[model samples]
Target: MGMDVYVGPLTRYTLGDWLTVVQQTMQAAGREVRIVHAEPEPEDVITDPVAVSDAVRSWQAGLLSALGSPEGWTDEAELPYWTDKPDWDGYGGMILLAAYDEQPEFRPGTRRGLLRRESRADSARAFQDAPAYKRASSNPTKYPTLLSGVEWWLPVEVAPTVFEAPRVTGQPARMGRVDQLVVELTLLAKRLGLDDDQLGQLRQAGPPDSSTDVEAAGRFGLAVFLELAHAAQLANQPLLLDY
Candidate 1:
């Protein structure tokens, strides 16, 4: 139950179903990697209760279409463990789930990817040089550029957090593996400073993530951490993390 969702660099056109691709890619080369889908949503949350439903449908379609493209960080090198035949350089992408007050609906489910025009464009630029602004300023069409779109609400758990959002509906998301998810989120325990007794209390008490009436608070604590991490990134702040 501890988890945090993050968006990272990816290769051009390597966006759709990347969880499977990354999993299979790592496994084929005998590397252990953790990846998971982090999408948070209330089964029936309506930001504009009247328009919430319509927005949800539209958001879902946008996410699906966005995922079809690819995400990338063309500037960095791949991880040391990367043995995949294809060079992992300049490959980056992002999947945004919801910022929920509860644990994601399930271990495996869809969440939201809140994409504001500014944030979407900002993220996309991380992938490719906005050709027009290149250092050379010569080849305009030589647009060695990356395009960034966004994924909206994906279907998943109906948590209490859903109702708390300024606009309750859907959000952004990510994909990978169950193990990676646990590690990604649990690592924050160091920052959370949970002692043995404190851990117990967190699990037993604290505010729920919004969905399930009751679940250990510690589990959703991780989800909250994940949400905060995303908020930081979208704001252009240091991502407390990105592993």
Candidate 2:
């Protein structure tokens, strides 16, 4: 019912194996860690380093092929992963992005009348009043980077043709670089009174306020997205906005 953001390998096999490696590595380092795979694997299959390495290689190759052999795409050497299922639904996500598009200086409390608890009619009116770029349309160019995709955001370097590639589910996906996403999110965090250090600390913080107040929802959604973007940057992984 809400967005489930994941920062990790794009392919199922790669993700499962990568998680296996993470679990083993952490356990070996005297830390208790357990990782649940996004994709379920057979209980009989044993995932080892060799399997993980092969899976990663195959994932990289498939991505290269899908992107038509784009130059300068490097395979990452490290895996830093993160995932979170925020409480905001798809509409909430769109509204938050649209709000940001309209007002980049969005704060927790502002009399801009952009954030308020609303009835169903009021909500629909708010959506209608959003900037033209954020509305649903067949013209892709009308959408901003954050609102372009309903489901996926690839970690590949920004390229004009990258947005044209099909998602793993065979649907159209969005293209964005990790650095670009991080920049946008960092700005939003600063508007909320969080600096780089405080923003990074959000990874360990509890969930944001869940009141029906639109401003609160927007802040919580932004925190979730910012955290995911940071994770994607660190892991050199795609950002999957799973519904």
Candidate 3:
């Protein structure tokens, strides 16, 4: 699977708070939610509400402790190592399984699992290929290849206060704030004829013709991001993204 990136607003809330948000969001939509523990015992699922909440709270604290913010944007030495399973000293994965009446096997699995699954399905990038800075901002443009679509100005360099992830690991991680994300996204969105009305339509209709044009793909990816950014701005949170 290719890397998929996401940009949204960040929240001051700890992982525990986000879990509560997830639970409440799911419940309000009228879906069944369960927490699964897959070790110490052979069991794969835990339906008890209290047990799940406690486990999630403990894991959140541990995760926060393990992840201390990096001091500088381009300081590669400060990047944090990543692991597939950050269970906070637990063998079992803390998963949130959801299902509606029509869909039974709607298992998103662990929070990270859900992010990875969605990124794969969506094909979003942590950073778009467009130039992050004006042509004059960097070195001379004599070598056009240096500004290839694959390259980008690190979010930390452009918007350090917003991006909190220590580094870009293989998995989803925080990148930049919504205000900066929107600004970067707008560069491509405007060139592709994606105005407010079009963005709104794309949000409603989902991604359209994303495979045909790079700008279109960026536009499609931002459809969800616009909403997420708005939510983050309201909640006073920073954006999380990876590619």
Q: Can you give the lDDT of residue 128 in candidate 2?
A: 36
State the C-alpha lDDT per candidate.
0.29, 0.52, 0.33
Score candidate 2 by lDDT.
Answer: 0.52
Best by TM-score: 2
Query: For residues 1-243, what per-residue lDDT tens digits would candidate 3 score against the true structure?
Result: 112222221111211123323345688999855534221232444444455545434543443454442322211211221111111111001000001101212222213434632322212232221123223123323212111222112223234422233322112343333455445445434544568788778667644443433234444455554555454444433343221
The regions of model 2 sitting more than 4 angstroms off are 13-80, 89-143, 197-205, 208-210
- Model 1, 1-243: lDDT tens digits are 122223332210122222333567688999977653344434553333335334433543454354442321121112111111111111111111111112222112223366322211212113234221232122211111111121111122222111112111222232222222333444444444544465445434534433332123334444444443344334322121221
Model 2, 135-239: lDDT tens digits are 432233323455554445556663442255554334455566666667666665665676666544543464455434554445556677777787777766777
> Where is model 3 more than 4 Å wrong at Cα?
1-13, 16-30, 33-174, 207-217
**Pairs clashing within candidate 2:** none
What does candidate 2 score on TM?
0.57
What TM-score fits each model? 0.22, 0.57, 0.36
Query: Which 10 residues in a row give candidate 2 its minimum summed lDDT?
Result: 117-126
Q: Candidates ranked by lDDT, best first?
A: 2, 3, 1
